[model samples]
Target: MSTKDVMIWRSNRAGTHYVADTVVMEEPLEIRIRFQDSDGKWVERPLSITMRTPGDDQALAVGFMFTEGMLLKNQLDKVTIGLENTVTVHFKPDVRPELEKLQRNFYATSSCGVCGKSSLDSLGYTYETLHLAENLSPLSPELIGSLPQKLTEYQSIFDETGGIHAAGLFDWEGNLILSAEDVGRHNAVDKIAGKALMQQSLPFNQHILMLSGRACFELLHKALALNIPVVVAVGAPSSLAIETAERFGQTLIGFARDGRFNVYSGIHRVDALVLPKK
Candidate 1:
């Protein structure tokens, strides 16, 4: 369901031909929350509507709530996937969410998640600083370089549509633990985080996050929310992304491809001995 076929006219130097083409699917998914209000009545409210590819909707909802600091794993009762592109998260009866504090207008596009924010202050969500063990083994540059190829093997949707973003989680040894894809880069990361949350795996402190596109501030912010210590991207990182990583002790690497990568922060996590010789 992640890809759809449509007829189009393809033109090349040889000639123009009518053919069926595949494209990544984009659709609106409404995320809702169900909890007991102060008056002891059950209340269900729309939280956010995001444009994303049509798989992993439940994880997206859970991840969104976790990153937004609205829902904790212990408070989650169950998730219900309804028709018409809607997902509802039911919380424990005692759990009351402070919906007023969330300044988002509840709409997010595939390109940007923060576009619906009502103020700049809401952008600064509290994040924990990462602290790696002194005895932890540093990741080698060769292992980092090999991640992109490994990630591609998991991107079944991208191979058909050629238009999707992916977020992959890898261990120190460079084995992919999980990966998710969506039209929005942030949603992809959210899906991965949501999956981990459902599996009772929070604080990805021992893993590396790999991005299929440029590392933006929002993506880094989500990574921080999940306590992922290292982030690698096939593209470049934004100025704010680098600042955030440097500020929070997370390692940020960009341009990771073809047996090379550039580490922007937390250089100590990457072994210096294996760096490509000039």
Candidate 2:
């Protein structure tokens, strides 16, 4: 278990009191890509160092590569858990990744997007999957309200620690398919995406992706990578995230709580009948 029992203090009108509290453990996970370089020399490249909760490290690594456009799911031969807190992806035969693009000098923090990808040119393009049609059924307001509840129920770790982010995939009727929790919001999304991808369940355009926290650029990109059309977030959305979702024709819903949510883009995916009159 990546959780610790710690002492916490509370102050009231009388005095300070201490209680044992559960805290989600955060650690640095290094992702390495081992492949033959352009010169036919075998090299292991450290791609990213992300601060995340201790579990699902391999999923985070594979999903990172796939969403970053470094390696496709088909190109993934297998992932190997290595020594010293690292996970490495080994591609199939005759497949090589662009090693130069991954040589960055920034540490990816749990609270933010992918590190070292700071240029407009780098973030400019969407993967080809975004062009597909998201022919999903109209979502009900009641269903939308129920998603957060489902997420809360499945978050056993967060229930204990109260210090993690979660992402879940739900059908139009609001049935939870898969949910993953992590210290990083992006890592949580990546974990769910990796699970679906490994199960050959990509292009989830008919489904919805829900986030437990604010929707950011990386989370939006992860949804797009999987061809997920409707993104429901419990918090606000970044300006770039809204713009990217609008451009890709994705329904970006923010502040999704208490039976209400704000759809910033691709509102066509949502039914106006379920919305309030302006």
lDDT of 2 by residue, 105-203 (tens): 358888876645564356656556365465566777778777887899999888998889999999777889888999999889888877776777776
Please provide TM-scores, in order, for all candidate models, with all chains considered together. 0.93, 0.90
List, residue by residue over 1-278, the lDDT tens digit for candidate 1: 88999999999998999999999999999998889988989988788889999999999999988877678778888889987899998999878777774435467899896554444245564443344333569888889999999999999999998999998999888999989999999999989988998898776789899999999888887887788889999999988789878877789999998988888998999887655889
Global lDDT scores for all candidate models: 0.86, 0.81
Cα deviation at 236, candidate 1, in Å, is: 0.5
Quality of model 2 by C-alpha lDDT: 0.81
RMSD of each: 2.6, 2.4
Candidate 2 clash pair list: none
Residue 176 error, candidate 1, Å: 0.9
Evaluate model 2: give its TM-score: 0.90
Best by lDDT: 1
